[model samples]
Target: MATTTASIRVPAPPERVWQLIGGFDTLPDWLPYIPTSELGEGGRVRSLTNEEGGLIVERLEVFDDKGRTYSYSILQAPFPVTGYLSTIAVHEEADAGSSRVEWSGTFTPDGTGEAEAVALFHGIYADGLEALRRTLAAGSAQGS
Candidate 1:
C-alpha cells in the first residue's frame, strides 16, 4: 500500500473552505479528475476523468460528517487498482482568518505487482493535490 498527503492553507475560513473541499459533489469544478459527486452516505459519485490512454470513472465513498474530518473510499473507479481510500481534514487557525486543509489517498495496483508502477501512482497523487492547491487559491481570491 502507498500513501500520500497534501495540504494547503486557504485564506478563506474553514467554514467557507469546507463549502469547497468538504463538499464532495462539487469536486469537478476545481479538481480536474473529479467531474461530479453525489453527496450523503451511500450516495453515487460520478466523474469525467482520463488516465493516460484510458478513461476514468469516478466513484466516491462518503463518511458521516460529525467533526472536523471526513473520509471515504473509492469502491469503483477507472483505475487498474483497488483499496482506494481518500480523506480530508479541516483545521482552524488561531488567527481566525485562514484554515489548514489536508487530504490524502491510498491504493494498490489492480493487476501489476511492480514497485515502479506503484511509484508512478504515487506521483499522480502528488500532482493531483498540487492541482487542488491552485483550485483552492482561485476560489479564495474569488471569494475575497
Candidate 2:
C-alpha cells in the first residue's frame, strides 16, 4: 500500500477548524480543487467533482466530533488506486490558540506505480490543507 500524509498549522481554534471540515459534504467548501460536491445516503456518501471535471465517490466511515477527526474510503475515483482510506484530524495547539490539522491516506496502486500514487495523493493533501488554512484565515478576518 502507498501511504501519504500532510499536516498544516492554522491560526484558528481546533473547534473552529473542525466546524469547517468535520462534515462529510464540506470538502468542496475547503478544497479548492473540488469545485462541486453532492451528498447522498444521508450524507454518508459524497460525490465530488474536481476542477478538471473528474469525479470521485467516497463513503464516510467514521466521524468523531469529540475526537475532532473523520475517516473515509474512496469507493470510486479516476486515480489508479484501490482500497483507499483517508483520515483527517484537527488538534488544538495549546498556548498558541491555534490548530494543527493532519490528513493521511493509505492505498494500493492499481496498475499505477506506487511512486505515482504517492505523489498524487501528496499533492492533493497539501493543496487541500492549504485551502483549508486560507479559508479559515479569511473567515476569521471577516469576523474581526
Candidate 3:
C-alpha cells in the first residue's frame, strides 16, 4: 500500500473549502482525472473517465462531513486496488483571514504506477483546492 498527504493554504475561509469538498460531483469541474462522481446518502459511486476516455469505477465508502474524511475502493478498473480512503481537512485560522486545507489518502496500486497515482492525487486535489479559493473569493454561497 502507498500513501500520500498534501496540503495547501487558501486565503479563503474554511466554510468555502468545505462547500467545494462537500459537492463530490463538482470534482470534475476542477480536477482533470475525475470526470465525475455520483454522490449518495452515506457514500458515492464515482466514474473517472480518463483523458483518453478510459473508465475507473470506485465506491466512495465514507463521506463524512462531520469527520472530514472519505473512503473509496476501486470496484472496476484497469488496475488492481482496494480499500482506498481520502481525507480532507479545512480549518480557519484564529485571525479569520486565512484557511488551511489538508488532503491525505491511502491506496494500494493494482499493478498501476503508484508514484504516478500519488502524484496525480496531489496535483489534481491541489488544483481543485485552488479552484475553490477562486470560487469563494468570487462570492459566497449557501453552506455545505
Candidate 4:
C-alpha cells in the first residue's frame, strides 16, 4: 500500500474549520478541483465531479464530530488506485485561534506505479488544503 499525507495550519478555530469540512458532501464548497457533488445513502456516500468532469464515488466510513475528524473510502475514481482510505482531522493549535488540518490517505496502486500514485495523491491533498486555507481566510476577512 502507498500512503500520502498533507497538513496545513489555518488561521481559524478547529471547530470553525470542522464546521466547514466535516460534512461528507461538502467538498465542492471549498475544494476548487471538485466542481460538483451529490449526496446519497443518507449522506453516507458522495459522488464528486472533478473539474475535468471525472466522477469519483466515496463512502463515509467514520465521522467523529467530537474528535473533529472523518474517514472515508473511495468506491470509484479515475485515479490508478484501489482500496483507498482517507482521513481528515482538525486539531486546535496552541496559537490563540489557529487550527491544524491534516489530510492523509493510504491506497494500493491499481495499474500505476507506487511513486506516481503517491505523487498524485500528494498533489491533490496539498492543493485541496491550500484552497481550504484560502477559502477560510477569505470568509474570515469578510465576516470581520
Candidate 5:
C-alpha cells in the first residue's frame, strides 16, 4: 500500500476548523473542486460531483466529533487506485488561536505505478489542504 499525507495550519481555532470540515458530506462546502455532495445511506455515504462533473462516491468509516476527525473510504472514483482509505483531522496547535489540519490516504495502485499513485494522492491532499486554507482565510477576512 502507498500512503500520502498533507497538512496545513489555519489561523483559526480547532473547533472552527472542524465546524467546516468534520461532516462526512461537507466536501463541497470547502473543496472548490467538488462543487456538490449528496448524502445517502442515512448520511453514511456521500456522492460528490467535481467541477468537471466527475463523480466520486465515498463511505464514512468512522467519525469522532469530540476528536475533530473522520475516516472514509472511496467506494468509487476515477483515480487509479483501490482499497483507498483516508482520514482528515483537525488538531489544536500550540498557539491556541491556530489549528493544524491533516489529510492522509492509503491505497493500492491499480492501473498505475506505486510512485505515480502516491504522487497523485499526495498532490490531491496538498491541493485540498491549500484550498482549505484559502477558504478559512476568506472566511476570516469577511468576518473581520
Candidate 6:
C-alpha cells in the first residue's frame, strides 16, 4: 500500500475549519475541483462531480465531530488505485486561533508504481490544502 499526508496551517479556529470541511457533502463549498456533491444513504455516502464532470463516489467510514475529523473510502473514482482510504482532520494550533488541517490517504496502486501513487495523492492533498487556505482567506475577508 502507498500512503501520503499533507497539512496546512490556517489562521482560523479548528471549529471553524471543521465546520467547513467536516461534512461528508460539503466539498463543493470549499474544494473547487469538486463542483458538486450529493449525499445518499442518509449522508453516509457522497457522490461527487469533479470539474471535468467525472463521478467519484465515496462512503464515510468514520466521523468525529468533537475531534474535527472524518475518514472515508472511495467506492468509485477515475484513478489508478484501489482500496483507497483517506482521512481529513483539523487540529488546534498552538498559535492563538490558528489551526492545522491534515489530509492523508492510503491506497494500492492499480497498474502503477507505488511511488507514482504516493506522488499523485500527495499532490492532491497538497493542492487541496492550498485551496482550503484560499477559501478560508476569502471567507475571512468576507467576515464569514
Top candidate, metric TM-score: 5
Pairwise TM-score winner, candidates 4 and 5: 5
* Higher-ranked by lDDT: 1 or 4: 4
Candidate 6 clashing pairs, residues 3+ apart or interchain: none
Q: List the residue pairs that clash in candidate 5.
A: none
RMSD to the true structure for each prediction, in A, is 3.6, 1.0, 4.1, 0.7, 0.6, 0.9
lDDT at residue 36 of model 2 (Cα atoms): 92
Candidate 2 Cα lDDT to native: 0.92
- Taking all chains together, each candidate's TM-score versus the true structure is 0.68, 0.96, 0.68, 0.98, 0.98, 0.98
Q: Model 2, range 81-130, lDDT digits (tens) per residue?
A: 99999999998897576999999999999988999999999998998999
The sequence of per-residue lDDT tens digits that candidate 5 reaches over residues 5-61 is 999999999999999999888888899999999999999999999988999999999
Model-by-model lDDT, in order? 0.64, 0.92, 0.67, 0.94, 0.94, 0.95
User: Relative to the unseen true structure, what is the C-alpha lDDT of residue 86 in candidate 2, on a scale of 0 to 100?
Assistant: 96
Writing each residue's lDDT as its tens digit, candidate 4 over 10-79 gives 9999989999999888898899889899999999999999988999999999999999999999998888
lDDT of 3 by residue, 81-111 (tens): 4566777677677768677877777878766
The ten-residue window of minimal lDDT in model 6 covers 23-32
Question: What's the true lDDT of residue 20 in model 4?
Answer: 96
Residue 38's lDDT within candidate 2 is 97
Report lDDT (Cα) of residue 90, candidate 5. Answer: 99
How many residue pairs clash per model? 2, 0, 1, 0, 0, 0
Clash count, candidate 1? 2
